[model samples]
Target: MFKKIDFSFEIKAIGYAFYFSFLPFLFFVFQFLFGEKELSFILLKQMEFLIVPFSAWWIIFLYHDYFEEGGSDLLYSYPLKAEEHGLLRIGVFSALYEILIAICCMFLIVRFPDANFFVLFIQYAAESLLYTSIGFVIILLTKKVMVPILMIVAYVSTEFLTEGSITPVFHIMSFNTEPLSLDQIIFSVLLNGCISVILFVFGHLYLRKKTDLRLF
Candidate 1:
């Protein structure tokens, strides 16, 4: 079925996602628990970074578990085609996160009427998608999750340390100091989203090639 995923995988993925999300959820919850009703720049930065890695770890785990730890033979035995399962993983998670990110955006908008809800939502989507794709591609290449996670940590740390001096239009905190016009925001979303899609497709291609290699 084009629409069905293994119920077991779904449950396990959700469980891992919860584990990955727990710390960030606590950070988010503490905002309200500590009388942080006013819009805080620190909160904005925290949300930005937290949202970036929100789904990334679980996604890496998904591929690593199925591909690396689960054994290559299991792939041939799975009900869904390899491509279908991978796409479903991305689709289901991205759709679920859209709602989650929307709720976060809504709460922030309520607290700060001046906040640009649209820009905030798009920014989070773009950044999360980009980072998740990075994790996705790297995991496929390295056949391990930790490598990509560490690589991302290093990459993001470098980006922050340099403060976008290397790539102004692409860094996560590019607009933290000076707000970007809506046009710039849209452009960044398009750029990052396009790159994410490319990496996703590239990962799929690698997966198919890998399977073919084992088959032949």
Candidate 2:
């Protein structure tokens, strides 16, 4: 299973994803260096707001190969079954994303040693998976990159326009005055994790039933 995964592809995708993810961090570093403590916090908050949308976008980018003409054919011709291949690819990408998050958190620790960033990292990771899985299902169903891209845009727009209160599930990373309770954390993880699993399973099944690469 591992042999089927293209480590080079995963690394390149992750590198691109982190390039976006680290933008806020770069601002945070600038603030820290200039002794702008207040601004650093604001930058961190902004990072939280941007992470989910960017993460979702990265997942969509990673799946672009599957939508290409010869690329889809090559993927389908692998030795493994379609569902197995898809699942392995998802697993690899998801794991790589989490690792990237962990690495970012290490850098964040240096800037805010007192913050409970471990918990925040878990929350962000769960939200990332949730958003990515939604995009994954959309791509598998429609086989068009633009559909999922638009869906992500609509979701981010709704979240921002409504201030994270309207669609709580989609805006899990939005700013909050108070710290999240243990129950809230558990709920977020469970809700997103369940939804991600269901979407992945449905996409796998849907892919298994299709014999051609035509985008519907």
Candidate 3:
């Protein structure tokens, strides 16, 4: 299972995306090395962008390899089933990201004692998994690299431009952000996690039909 994941992750684009994903965590490194412990809410909030998006890109990258590059022809003959492979790859990447987010939250507990680790974890996990699952469905459905990219751009822009009330914790986490409440976390988790699970199931079902695997 790990070997197959490694094979899928070895792509040049995924390699770069993997490294780029860590760019947000550099703040933690800077704080540790320089003892710059005054972690402002705005600075912490800025980390949200780099954290969730690249986490979603892993499976999309695999779709490029599996379908766009003619790897699906070979994959149909592999020992593992397509759905199994997709699930394992997504599971590994999502676990790694969730672990990383926990580590950062742990460090925040020390430096920023008032920080709410529980709520943050829930929010990040929900956002990450939602987008990850979105990437899975979008890539498999359209087989186009740019569709999901544009959708993500539009989604984020709408949130920022209109400052819409579309998200659960937006007001809680935005301007002069405070530690989110348990109710907000619960709602956000349910909303995003349910959608992610539904999309994941759909993608898994879609991947099962080898004959339907064609580019748009």
Q: Which structure among the candidates has the greatest lDDT? A: 1
CA lDDT scores, all candidates in order: 0.69, 0.64, 0.67
The reply for model 3, stretches above 4 Å from the true place, is 1-4, 7-13, 27-39, 165-176, 211-216
Per TM-score, the best of the predicted structures is 1
**Residue ranges of candidate 1 with Cα displaced over 4 Å:** 13-18, 35-39, 166-169, 172-181
Better of 1 and 2 by TM-score: 1
Alpha-carbon TM-score of each model against the true structure: 0.84, 0.76, 0.79
Off by over 4 Å in 2: 9-35, 107-112, 165-170, 177-181, 211-216
Prediction-by-prediction clash tally: 0, 0, 0
Order of models, best TM-score first: 1, 3, 2
RMSD of each: 2.8, 3.6, 3.7
Candidate 1 backbone collisions, by pair: none
Looking at model 3, the pairs that clash are none
Global lDDT for candidate 3?
0.67
Rank by lDDT, highest first. 1, 3, 2
Looking at model 2, the pairs that clash are none
